[model samples]
Target: MMIANLTGMRSFLILGFPGLSPKHYGPVSALLFFIYLAIAIENIFILTFVIFEKSLQKPTYLVFCHLALNDLTFGTLTLPRIISKYWFGDSIISFYGCFTQMFFVHYLGSVTSFMLLVMTLDRFIAICIPLRYPVLMTNNIISVLCGFAWFIPLPLVVAIVLHALTLPFCKSNIIAQCYCDHISITSQACGENVKIVQVTTLCMAMVCLLLPLAFIVFSYISILVVILKMSNAAGRKRTLSTCTPQIFITCLFYLPRCFVYVSNTVGFSFSLDVRIFLILWYSLLPAAVNPIIYCFKTQAIKEMLKKRLRKTKIGIKIQLSY
Candidate 1:
């Protein structure tokens, strides 16, 4: 029944949107579809690299691994389903299946948001109190942080799923996006999603997003104050150089999130295409962009990638020699 609901709604969009018409946006759509394919591929390599490589076992790399995994899940939550609409044309999904997608969409998002906060805290301890870095971010503590990242969102998702089971089907089931996002469900909402909006916004933006951003702000501020007081000019410069990339990456995540929170609250009544397009821009683009930023922005990740490439070539040569 849930699958039927999801399928019927997706079929409606494929049939109704006339989005494929080759007039204005066709080229743009085609370009985005291809870009998403590359995003999917890059994230796959990143995830695999993080998972199988013992060299990436440091605290910083551990966070990167989790980020890569979240990126894979984040992209999967929407892109595959969207790609299917174009490639397969309106696939069927059970009601429970829709719940599953919705759950993951929330799940990955909640985790990513929390991960950003923890990443900030990790950086905070490392930079501000360098003497205690080892004792501060222990593996046992990180496991607890990881647990909080995931465990916090379950109740909200369970609520959404339970809500889905109760929503009456009239001729009212129209999903405007390529996939079912929470906002789309709210647009078709038959019951209490006002709280969903408030709580989810609070969780996603305030607790997870804004709080970390604030920490990033304060952490960097504190770091700068310390740098100013440092007697060794060379030490201060080195610290700033190392800190610059992390700060830039924080901006990349935070700026867009600010926009998303405002847009979601203000533009709830806009046309379906407009609303969904905005949501997709916020949700999907960040996940794809983060790895690129990490590679380009952070010296450590760049060096790691280069080191891995060298190892790959060495392995290839050995294989050929045998």
Candidate 2:
């Protein structure tokens, strides 16, 4: 009732890293701004390369395109507002604004997790069942899978935000974390039933994180068995080479997340600062690093970059000759 009365007027104050000193806010905000810039530029580079390079159009790179786009959207949804909180002291976010941010944060996370699963499945099909790779995985099928990955999480996340909105927020309007999130927002709800929302959010997060992980585990195991049986050492090496980047990316995305959730479940505690650091570490670090992984680990992208450089150099040389 109270929350409804203040519907359009309701807003929340975001307190980013509550333990940090006022003096450090400038440095920290600058650092975050640069990181956000890097994430944007890197992911945009990948998307542009995938768009223009016909040679790179395949199931694997298609998934990379989706991952890059997801990272861009996720970073945009999360970083700038928090950056403002520290840099300009613009900490207030309105009711609908906070809910909108929370919805996309969870929604894009689910999309990334599913995108990783799709990457693993691409590898599984390529290595585990080589003959059917062409038939089982095609551009059209990849397109459909990408579509489902983005679409499937919409209803679940909407339900979460809607439920959170209905809860009476007679408690404090100050959010302790950097950005609006399901747990952070719901913690400020004033009612005994808030526990129900917490439990359900936890379950949803576990399913989103763990279910893709289970399939990833199964896919890798099958991939490994096939790789071990290959008579040709060169082929085995090549196969492992192809799988390694995705493996690095998978570990990057999932391991920190698992550690945090597991620590919470087992009664282990971190300082609020440390907990916030870990959340940002897992959420943002992967986006910053993923493009680097694709650029360095994938041979095709490397070759394309090399060709572009060579062309640039030749053009400069021709001008010098003139």
Candidate 3:
């Protein structure tokens, strides 16, 4: 039975994993449920801690704060409905609703790439131009840049979705992937306009992914050169240590994407199952792991978290004794 609202927009049935057996749906949904919870808890802890901690009110930490927020938003935006799909056999999403999800998915993804670029720039200045770092990249400047990162891609995303809406989705309402994305939705579109939409969206995605990535590589190379030239061993160690988390997280975010792009370019493609697995792996894994990286790598945050954990343990013990 097809359900539509007063607007007469048809609903799309999301196939979380097209190849998975019906019997496995329960386990898959349960796994995703836990991952969603982990993403939520870890990022929420980072956001909450950053907001309340006075000592962590620097531009660099604030950049991390923005990243944590982005991860949380991205997970929340993409996960719940799919979880519903597998857990309750509810795969239907309204046409406009699917488009809305698609827009935010791409938009948040663009913002994350830009934010990583911002972080690279932040590190570059702090390491290479230490003397002018204070005057050059102030908190307010970083704040404005982060604000721009989040909002600047809005129009492009909107335009892409708008163009997609113009396409006639007259046939299949079933999306093969877990969620509504540009590729999945546009594939359902009929007519010659489909190619145009695909090409345009691909071009936009390449720009969003590559441009910032180029700068990140350049900035990191410069940072590496600067680190190598440092005479003080401890200083170099400390500097590299600070960058470890970002480098790791950046790799987590970008490497899989680069692999997929390269595979596509070389006329090689993954099985649908592998492609879907890679998508979920790269998209959600980094968000869930980022907080752990920051917690352990940054001395201040690590110490603070340890103190909080100890306090919690003590409180639990006292409660149990009563």
Candidate 4:
């Protein structure tokens, strides 16, 4: 937020508000802490609802449960730092601290992206290949795929950690973004021999992000055509609405990623204002938005939450009456 302020309004707008500001960090920290607490409380409610409610037990909702967990992983990674810095203003991070944050951000981010691809593919199979979906997206398949998503990025993060940590930081160690982002580090390291940053960025994008995005696009395009031809507007709306939250999430992530990649590889002197703004929007706001998107966009989940909360309140009242 301070970075956005320093950069100017153009920078702040480009970054999209994560609902924080330079002057507001002290108070803003309290708000974020409450937000994080709410996320935790909401998640606890979700898990409890899923566990006790047999009707809600299914592969699709299970996938959603996993997504909520992933949100926590990504959310906690960035939010605490914001809260701490705002309350304490202790903005300095050690080598391990910054890398730890980056590793989780990248790892969980990749997992979430891949899981979203798996989700659309799951829907495609279920809708397009209905009989097989039950057999195909079985507990074992979900387990294996989710496990694979969890582990696939470990090796990639390990390599990045090594390369990034190995770089000597005789220059200024202060990271410019809200968190320790790769571009910020690379920019500081850049000189005549910026080849390493370019190569690493390319390799990371290709092997980590691009492949999954390609698959997602291909999968969705085919599914959309099939839905469009269904001749039932209601059916088509249902299918698309089911995927709306996921689509919104994907576009938010991929769009800035496109911007970041262009800025990094093309060696464009991307205005510092522009760059910082992009980083915040790309990294922070997504976590805050994910839960709200799910609750609002998906009626089933919304109802589930409401029913559980109502029941819990009644139970408490009953106990108190005793």
Candidate 5:
């Protein structure tokens, strides 16, 4: 059998959903638009709050800022293209464009998993080794860690993208999801190299997803032991409260991701729509919920929001009087 040639310009048609109709696209697009908007606004607010509030300059809050920025970038890189696909029926993406999208999607996702690990370490230090935390998690140290989280994934993802580019994608031009990703794009290639792609992708997933997850679990376990040893109830409550948001966000990210990887590795049969939904859930849901969790759960952020609200109200009242 002769495989198609990959010598010319190629484009992909992103089928937003497998069974969705033209009539359903409108409502679905609107819903996704609002979700994207909400994710952007919430993350931007958190990022701005942390940047402006001098009191929030601690290592822990700085990690929050980093995560918020990650969420903002992740949502921006993904949702607009997807929204356009459903809203205007513009599903065609150029060859390079699809690869670019795939690169960033995996890159930022790996960065986020590492960021969660960083947060877990922050909490572990604050709770388990409180005396040394001030010395250990200095601004400079946190800066270096955050830089590592941001840049470390670049080379790995670049290697993956380079390998993917070598594969001949002449078999199909239709992506069965709202956006491009490593697995989705590579699966369309026509060659025996598919197994290589799958194995390499699974390896990347283990490195990017499972490694950080293990660190997070270990950090929390140590922290839990420390919390249990603490005799003061109030102190225990405060510590748990501070750690809750990160824990929730971690679960939001890793649980679905683990499921997707395990299912793929085991050849579990999931419907096309269900797989798409799982991908969207793991990718978008954490971005939407992270800021909400931080704002509602973190006392400092609540106070900052309240203070800002009061200032806005006072400015409005003065304007009306004038």
Candidate 6:
């Protein structure tokens, strides 16, 4: 078996939206730039609000803070390169760089998946086992769960990334998508071992993506049963309200992924441009809308933003008078 030397540098070109017309580049780049900016600012606001507000430091809010951080990191890792690809025409990345990007892209995704699961558990306890929720989801326990969500995916993703790095990439170095990902990069490797990469990728998807999705579905079903048992209309309404945002976010994250995975597993084909667009849509859309969903749906966050805006207005008035 031939081994690729890790010491030598290899680079890959990220082809963003193949056959994109030069005329549409400016509008597309501008739109993406604003979207990236919105994601950054919105997530930062969520993190800051959760951290500084004493009333918002419950287990639920802590999870939101972690999610905001995850979105910020995911957006930061992905958008800049693609933005530059469209704006400045800089898309080539070094071999190690590609691996690094690929690792975090999947790693953070796995973390987000688990975080959503953790959030589901939080909601389940609060709604289904209200009497025991305080004991079950104590501050210490929530902290531990948060740590697990962030760190548990590390070893699994590391193993996969190392395996991909060792594969000989003697084929075309041009990636069809705007970012480096496990499947896109692995597809370019030249050898029978490529089949191993494909199988492993599929297994990783099942483990990292499907498992969390299953747990989320189960958690929601349990919550629904509990809610239905509640005879008090107000109580039932409150419980459903608390759950709505999470359900929306979870569906946003998982549905597109499920589609992509099933399509690949069944050998369902899509045009290259369509595939790239879907990948970009799922990856970026969730990050962009997550904070917005929370802000609009969660009363606590909405009130906090209202107070902050009022304070800003008062400060502006004082400055104008001066």
Give the candidate number with the greatest TM-score: 2
How would you encode candidate 1's per-residue C-alpha lDDT over 1-322 as one tens digit per residue? 1222422343223222334453534454565677677667767776776667666666766776677778777776667666665555554544456657777876677677777767777777887898998998876787678778777766756665565555533334556666665655555544454465535544553554556567667877887888889899999888777766566556666676677667677964556566566667767776677777767766776888899899999999999999
Clashes of 6: 0
Candidate number with greatest lDDT: 2
Better of 1 and 3 by lDDT: 3
- In model 1, the runs with Cα more than 4 Å from the true position are 1-33, 91-93, 191-216, 231-234, 263-274, 308-322
Model 5, 78-131: lDDT tens per residue?
Answer: 898889988987888888999999999999999998998888888888888889
lDDT of 6: 0.88
Question: How many clashes would you count in candidate 3?
Answer: 0
Answer with 3 or 4, whichever has the higher TM-score: 3
Decide which is better by TM-score, 4 or 5. 5
CA shift of 273, model 3, Å: 1.3
Score candidate 5 by lDDT. 0.87
Model 4: per-residue Cα lDDT over 203-318, one tens digit each: 88477787888888887887788788888899989878877877787787788878787878788766655666677567656566666776778778788778878999999999
| Cα distance off (Å), candidate 2, residue 279 | 0.4
User: What lDDT would each prediction earn against the true structure?
Assistant: 0.65, 0.90, 0.89, 0.69, 0.87, 0.88
Q: What is the lDDT of residue 12 in candidate 4?
A: 13
lDDT of 2 by residue, 11-73 (tens): 888877989999999999999999999999999999999999999999999999999999999
CA shift of 45, model 3, Å: 0.5
lDDT of 3 by residue, 224-272 (tens): 9999999999999999998998898899999998888889999998889
- Estimate TM-scores for all models: 0.78, 0.96, 0.93, 0.80, 0.94, 0.93
Better of 2 and 6 by lDDT: 2
Instruction: Kindly report which residue stretches of model 3 are placed more than 4 angstroms away from their true locations once superposed.
Output: 1-9, 309-322
